[model samples]
Target chain A: MRNIRIAVSYDGTTYHGFQTQPIGNTVQDVLEHAIRMLTGEQTSVTASGRTDAGVHARRQVINFETSSPIPVNRWALALNSWLPGDIVVLQADEVAPSFHASYNARRKTYRYGIDTSKFGDVFERNYRLHYPMPLRLQEMKAALAHVVGKHDFTSFASRRSTKTSHVRTILDARMEESEGKLDIFLTGDGFLYNMVRIIVGTLFWVGEGKLSADDFKRILEARNRTAAGPTAVAHGLMLWDVEYDD
Target chain B: MRNIRIAVSYDGTTYHGFQTQPIGNTVQDVLEHAIRMLTGEQTSVTASGRTDAGVHARRQVINFETSSPIPVNRWALALNSWLPGDIVVLQADEVAPSFHASYNARRKTYRYGIDTSKFGDVFERNYRLHYPMPLRLQEMKAALAHVVGKHDFTSFASRRSTKTSHVRTILDARMEESEGKLDIFLTGDGFLYNMVRIIVGTLFWVGEGKLSADDFKRILEARNRTAAGPTAVAHGLMLWDVEYDD
Candidate 1:
């Protein structure tokens, strides 16, 4: 058996989520179905992480073991022929048999977009959260400054998260505002379920003057899910990139 | 009655087209429906021009006379409350009583996007034409230079057009290539039905070495629709802007 790794990008608006579900269509289900048709083998594909419904991914790494004799580099073109227009395979490579898409990941980056235009951008409505209200960018930046470095991240995670450890290290957190839009970028060693969304939600509150930079720090230290703001909508968030050791 | 002129933007993927149709919902139908709901008046709307199905508009000028007491500046906000997410009212103004959206237009600009990326762009699938094949940008540019100035563009217009005259002045024609995408921008005093799309299709053929720069001029002079290449798909085209005399 050979472990094949592939980088994929998808527009998740019409998908249920990255993981397979008992009901409704998902990115995983579509990929697996495409693979089954291509290789004549029913194989389970594992991803770096599962994204919520309506969350896009610029680059999501996944791995699956297959006994097919097809060249490793030809996997992307082969699978793309079977996949829908919303999902695209970027590249494919052969990896060591022990490599795992989920467990072997080193860091991940996520981006959240907020459209502040009064009338909103119609073409990008599906990709951004339309928050027409004015926001204090400097205050939001100050709040983000408190999010860097190691923290428990329990307050930023979803209440339904069942992870054994709530601790995570945030490598970087920053915001970019331009052309009536605000984008937040966060990079971390690992994230709990809905962690990035909750963090962005809290930052929005800070920008709205509902909370101060100090309050963001207190929320992080509180390590209580209820202490943080609500989770931002899934459509506004995107899994940008995942990094692995060379 | 006030002649309310509104600048609107829409993602046209879901609509039938810009004009009213008997069987399907169109941008005009939706706008009239929303206006009826907002002002309780069943009034028809006039646009600078009609765009085909799956074609987007960055700024489409439309006008409708209304007896509602709402302020001109408030029309945008009020109408937006009733419009769907894919369509937006950007601005509203009380134009001259005799001003017409279609008749008063002086010039128009249309843009067509061609994505030359290897795997195509999933996020922009609806907004661009995915042509992974190599294109000769210089050759395409040389062909576009022949498009400028006045010409009888019967070969570029759709055969279904009933216009008496085919002469039109192209103010400018240019191409921009970057990041694996080539964008064609054409500004003209006026265009016939599917003129921009047909021109783009012919340019694609030129880029692929199927046609030469001199052949394009010859085809324009041929004064026959069949002399030109096939009409490009509607999804890659956008009504970028329109101009009217003050």
Candidate 2:
């Protein structure tokens, strides 16, 4: 058996999520079915992480063991031909059997895009959040500073989570604003369910002057989901990139 | 009766174009129906020009005569509630009673967007053309010079046009390129059907070294539709804006 790794990008507006479900309209379901048809093997594919419904991904890594005779480099083109237009395998490679898409040591970067352009950009209507309200960039930055570091992220986690521990390390966090568009980028060792969206929602509150930077720190220390703002819209969030040791 | 002018924008990928048809799916058909539903009166809506199927518009001028008691300022908000998300009315104003959407226009600006970004952009999937070939920018600029002044543009027109005269003035023509993207902006007194798209297609051939600058000049003077390159795809073309001498 050979372990094959593939990098994929997808527009997730019409998809249920990255994980397989009973409904079978998710990105994972579509990709697995295409792989099954092409390689004639019914196998489970593991992803770097799962994204919610309506979320996008610029590059999501996945791995699976297959016994097919096809060359690893040609798997991308072959599978893309069978997959839908929204999901595309950007590249494929043969990796060591020890490499796991989810458990391997690495960091991930996510971005939440907000369209401040008045009347909004029509081309990005499905991929971004149209926020017409005024935002204080400086305040948002201050709030972001309090989020960088290793800490218990229970305040940023989803209420439905059943994790054994909520501790995680936030490597970097910053906001990029230009041309009436704001993009919040966060790099971390890992994220809890809905953590990035909840962080962005809290930053928006800071920009609106409703939540101060000092208050954000207190909320983080509280280690409770109810202590933070609402989770940002799912469509605004994107799994931008994943990094692994060479 | 009062003449109300509206500036509208739309993602026209799914519509049958800007003009009303017996098919009842055109932009005009949808707009007129929404007006009737909001103002309780059936009215004929006039547009500055017609757009082909799958073409978009950032700003299209439209006017209509109505007897409703609603103020013009409120029409945009009221009509937006009734229209689909793809179409939006940007602004509304009262024009002179003699004003016409199709006849009383001054100048119009159209743009053709090319996704020089390899593999195209996910968000702009429906708004741009994916042209991955290398382009000679200097040669394209030189070719655009031959198409700048007043000329009989019969070579760039489509066969479905009913206008008697093919003579038109090209007020301005230029190409804007940035960050693996190219945009061709053309401002003209008026245009024949499919004029901008054909001109773009012809310029692309010049960039590819298939046609020289001098050959483009002769094509312009030939006064024949077969003298030029094929019409570019409708998805890349957009009616950017319209200016009127008020």
Candidate 3:
């Protein structure tokens, strides 16, 4: 059997999330079913990470083993034909047998989009967070600088996470605004559950003048979830890119 | 009664179209309802144009008359608070008593988005047209030249149109491709019914090698509905902007 790596993209609005659940539809369930129909092999596929419902992914990595004789490029077309319109396999290729989708990931980048206009956009409701108030960009930028390096991000992690390590390395964090839209981009070695959302919410507080930059720093040192702001909505977050090293 | 002009935006996925329809919800119905809720006034609103079902608008011009003493900026906030999340009043101001949303327009711009990747985007399913094959940009550009002049666009209009004059002047027509996405932008004095969609369809056919640039020009001269390509899906089109001369 050959191990195949597939790069996928999905609009997660219709999905329960990236991982399969017993109650609702998932990106994984539909993808696995499509693979089964194409190759007639009941193979379990693993992704680089799990995204919550209403979140989107531009380039999500997944890997599975199959014995089918189909060419690598055909995997994308074959699987996509059976999959629904909301999920699609962007590219597929053969990989080393030792490669693992989850274990081999080097870094992940996520983008949180906010529409700061007084009025929201009708078409982008599913993809962006609408915040009517004018955000203080300079204050938000100062607060972001405090979270750019490695730290124990317990303040930003969700309480439901089972991971023992609360520390992670944050490579970069920045905010960009254009045409009345504000986007916060974060790149890290790995993220804890709801880490991105919580960080965004905390930054929003800074933008709103409710929390100062020093307060953000204090929250980081607290190492407690209660110190951070509320988790932002799921729809505003997107897994923009996942990096893997050879 | 004071004449009020408002800039509106709507996600057209759930509505039958922009105009009021007996069959399904519309942008007008929602906007009128929101206005009635805000001022307790029976108001009649007129739009610059009636957009078809599943077609979005970024800045649609609308007008109404009311005696309410509310401030201009408050109109947006009040109407938005009562309107559904899919529709929003971006701005509101008092216009001259004789100002008409439909008759006083100087120009309008429409944008059509196409995702040409082999895999479709699930998140943009309601906002873009997904074509799996690679498109020829040069051919599409060549065809666009034929559409950038004054002409009777009966060939590009639907037979169901009620407008008496099919002649319209196209100021600009261009195609842009970025990040595997293709966008067609058209600016004109006005458009015939389904004119923009049919033009896009014909350009798509030209890009796909099914038609030539000369063929597109021939169709424009035919002045018959059968000469043009099929009307592209409404979901892929957006009323991007409307311009008025003071």
Candidate 4:
């Protein structure tokens, strides 16, 4: 069997999520259905990770083994033709059998959006969290700086995380604002389940004056899930990019 | 009875347009239902203008007579409590009995968005027209300049327009692009049926080298609906704002 890797993009607004549900609408179910219609093969696709409901993805990498004779390069256009308008196959690539979509990933970046505009933004109402409260950008930046570097992210992970180890290397983190639109970016070698959302929640608390940089560091050292802030809603989070060693 | 005016915002993605439909879901149907639930009144709302299907609105001025004793300032918050998340009341005011939502309007501004990036923007797929083709900005600007000021807008109007007079005054028109997102802005005293869509379509033809700036001016003077390019789709057109004499 040949291993085929594909990069997919989707608007997760009305979707159940990237993972397959028992009978709900999901990105995976739609993609697999499209592939079956075109190639007459029922295959399971392995994705980089499971994105929660309402969490969008700019490019989510997935891989599957298929015996279809169609060229790998043409898979993108063919699959996109059968897929729904909300989900699109951005690109496709042939890879070695050893190239895993999740375990072999090197880095990933996530973005969280906060709309701080006093006036409601009608067009972006579904994409970002509308937080009209005043925020201190400098304080958020200072707190974000402390989140970078290698550490145990136990406090930032969800209670349902089945991974044995919580240690991860956060390569970079930053915050920027454009006309009351705040963007928080986080890049890391790997992330625990709900790590990005929890981090954003903690940063929001810091910006709201409910926590400090020192308190965030202490929570990280505590290595307890209860020490961290609440998780941000899924609608405001996006899987921006995922890097895999070529 | 008091004449209550309110500015409303809505995401028109799933709506059948601003007008009330016989069966399908519409912005007017939803807003009227919400108003009925809040005030127990079945008054008809008068809007500044009707937006086509899939067209959004940032601030659509609307008014209706109501016997509710709630303060006008608090109606915005109360009405929004019952409305769906996609539609929101931006502001509310008690207008004079003579104040009319449609007839008292002096100016209206519309914004059309174009996604010029090579790659598909997943988030903006529904809100913008994905036109990856190369466009000449200078040519589009020059064509837009000829469209400004007073003109017989018969060529720029839809064939289905039923207005007695086709002459209208375009106050301003401009084009701006940032980060591969192009925005065409137009302001006018009023517009004919589908005038903004046709204007954008004509400008698009000019940018693509299909029509010159001089040809655009000639087309305007032709006073014929068939003299201009096809009308653009309604998804990219947004009623940005409406001005009143008050």
Candidate 5:
């Protein structure tokens, strides 16, 4: 058996999520279906993590074992012919037999986009969160600065998480603004369910003057999900990148 | 009755086109329906021009006569509440009684986007044309430069056009490239049916070295539709702006 790793990008507007489910079509379902048609093997593909419905991905990593004789580099070209326009295989490579896409991931980066323009752009309605109200940019930046470093992120995680430990090490957190749009970037070793979306939601409150930067820190220390703001919509979030040890 | 002029923008992926058709829903149909719901008037709207199916608009000028007493500035917000998210009224104003959207227009601008990346972007699939091949940028620019000034555009127009004269003045034509993507901008006093798309199609031939710059100029002088290249797809084109004499 050979372990094959692939990077993909998708416009998740029509998909249920990244994982295979019994009820609805998903990114994994389409990928595996394409693989089955190309290789004639019933194989399972593992991804770094799952993204929610309407969420997008710039680069998502996946790994699968195959016994086919096709060259590794040709897999992307072959699979893309069977895949739809909304999902594309960016690159494919042969890795060690023991490589695991999920467990071997070292760090992941996510980006959230918010458009504050009056009457949001028509072409970007599916890709950005439209928040027309004025925002306190400096306050939002100050609040995000406190999000870096190691912490128990229970307050930012969704209640659906069943993990025993909510502890995760955040490597970096920052925001960039241009032309009435704000992009928040977060890099971390691991993330819980809905962690990024909840963090962005709480920052919206800080930007709206309902909570101060110090209050944000206190909420993180509280370690209660109710202490955070509402979860932001999923369409604005994108899986930016994934890293692994070489 | 007062003449209300509105500038609107639409994604155009879901609608049939800008003009109302007998079989399918269109941007004009939606706007007229929204007007009926808001003001109880079955009003007719006139646009600067008709866009083909799947063509987008960044700023389309439209005018309608309304007997309802809604203020001019509030029309955007009121109409937006009744319209879908894909279409938005950017601004509204009270214009002169004799001002017409189609007849009084002075100039119009359009933009076409092409992606030459190895693998096209998923998020921009609906907005740009994906042509994964090397292009001769200098040749395409030279070919486009000859398109400026008044000329008989019979070769670039579609066979369906019934106009008596095919003469039009192209004010400016240029292109800009960034990160494997090219944006072509064209401004003119007017365009015939499918004129801009046919021009882009001919330029594509020049980019691929199938035709030379001087050959493109000769095709324009031929004044025969069979001498020109194919008509490009409509989804990559956008109505950028419309200007009228103040």
Candidate 6:
């Protein structure tokens, strides 16, 4: 069997999430079903990370083993024919047998989009968060600085998480505005459960003048979920990219 | 009664077209209904131009006479609250008594979006046309030059058009690529029925090596609908802006 690596992009509005779930539709369930139909083999695919329901992905990475004779490049075309319109396989490539999508050492990037216009965009309602109130960009930037380094993000993590480690390295965190959209881009070695969403919520509070820049530092030092801001909605969040070491 | 000019935006997937149609829902129908809901008066709203079925609008200008007590700016907010999620009123202001939405327009701009990636973007399917093959940008540029400037666009127009004159000034026509999307922007004093779609189709033919640059000139000079390329799908077209000379 040969291991294949695939890059995917999906509109997560109709999906329950990236992982397979017992009750609803998921990106993994549909993808695996498409692979099974293409290769006539029941394949279990693993992704680099699992995103929440209504969270989109631009370049999600996944890997699986298959014994089918179909060429690697043809995987996208074959699988796409069976997959729904909301999910797409961008590219497929052969990888070393030892390669694992989740264990590969590298960084990941996520972006949360916010529409700061007084009026919401009807066309982009599914993809962006509409915040009618004006945001203070400078204050949001000040709060972002506190979360730019490696630290224990227990305060930002979801209370339901079972992960043992609360420590993660954040490579960059920046807020950019263009064309009536405010985009928060964060690159990190990894993230705790709901880390990015919690961070965005905290920054939004700072932008709204509800919290100061120093409040972010206090929350991080507190290491308690109650000290952090409310988590933002999932639709505004997107897994922009997943990078794996060559 | 005051003549109010309103700027509107809509996702046209559910509408038949901009004009009031007998069978399917139209932008005019929705707007008129929303206006009636805002005020007890039954009013007639005239748009700057009629877009084809399934065509979207980022900014469509319309003028209507109303005796309602709602302020001009408040009309937008009020109508938006009553309208469906697919349609929105961006701005509203009172216009001169002599102003006409259709007759007073000096120029209009339309943008056609094409997704040229091998794999289509799931999020933008409703807003863009997916073309999997690689496009030759240079060839497209060569063909675009043939359409710029004042000329008779009879060949690019629909055979069913009732316009008396085919001469229209094309202020600008250009193609731009951004983030895996190709945008074809056209600015003109006016357009014939399906003129922009036919132009895009002809340019796509040139990009695909189906038609030569020299052949485009001959096709334009033919002054026959059969001489031009097929009309592109309507969903990818957008009425971007309308410029009125004071």
lDDT (C-alpha) at residue A43 in model 3: 88
Worst 10 residues of 2 chain A by lDDT: A117-126
Q: For candidate 2, lDDT tens digit of each residue in B1-246? A: 999999999899999998877776999988998999998999989999989899999999999999888987798889888888788888899999999987888999999999886455666667888787899888899889888889999999998778899999999999999986899999999999999999999988898999988888899999898889989999999999999989
Worst 10 residues of 1 chain B by lDDT: B134-143
lDDT of model 3 at residue A63? 97
For candidate 2, lDDT tens digit of each residue in A1-246? 999999999999999999999987999999999999999999899999999999999999999999998998789879988988788787899999999998984999999999997567666778889896899889889889888999999999998988899999999999899997899999999999999999988888888989998888999999988889989999999999998884
RMSD of each: 1.2, 2.1, 2.1, 2.2, 1.2, 1.7
Alpha-carbon shift of residue A156 in model 1 (angstroms) = 0.8
Clashing pairs in 1: none
TM-score, model 6 to reference: 0.96
**DockQ, each predicted model:** 0.87, 0.42, 0.76, 0.47, 0.79, 0.71
Number of clashing pairs per prediction, in order: 0, 0, 1, 0, 0, 0
What is the C-alpha lDDT profile of model 6 across B1-246, one tens digit per residue? 889999999999888999987885899988999988888778889999999889999999999998887877688789989898889899999989999999999999999999987789888888899997888888888888888899999999999989999999999999998878999999999999999999999888888889988888889888888988899999899999998986
Docking class of 3: medium
In candidate 4, stretches whose alpha carbon ends up further than 4 angstroms from where it belongs are none
- Every candidate's chain B TM-score: 0.99, 0.98, 0.98, 0.98, 0.99, 0.98
DockQ of prediction 2: 0.42
TM-score of chain A, every prediction, order shown:
0.98, 0.98, 0.98, 0.97, 0.99, 0.98
After superposition, the stretches of candidate 6 with alpha carbons farther than 4 Å from their true spots are none
Q: What stretches of model 1 exceed 4 Å from their correct place?
A: none
True contacts kept of each: 0.94, 0.17, 1.00, 0.40, 0.80, 0.74
Model 6 score (lDDT): 0.91
Preferred candidate (DockQ higher): 4 or 6: 6
Give candidate 6's chain B TM-score: 0.98
TM-score comparison, 1 vs 3, better candidate = 1
lDDT of 3: 0.90
Give the alpha carbon lDDT tens digit for every residue of B1-246 in model 4: 999999999889889999998876998888888889989999789999999899999889999889999998788888888988889898999999988899999999999999997656777887789898899899889989998899889999888999998888989999989996999999999999999999899989998999999998999999998889989988899999999988
Q: On a 0 to 100 scale, what is the lDDT of residue A195 in model 1?
A: 92
lDDT tens digits, residue span A1-246, model 3: 999999998988888999989985999989889999998999899899999999999889999999999999788888889988778788889999999999999999999999876677677777899997877899899999898888999999999989999999999999998986889999999999999999999999999999999999999999999989999999999999999996
Clashing pairs in 5: none
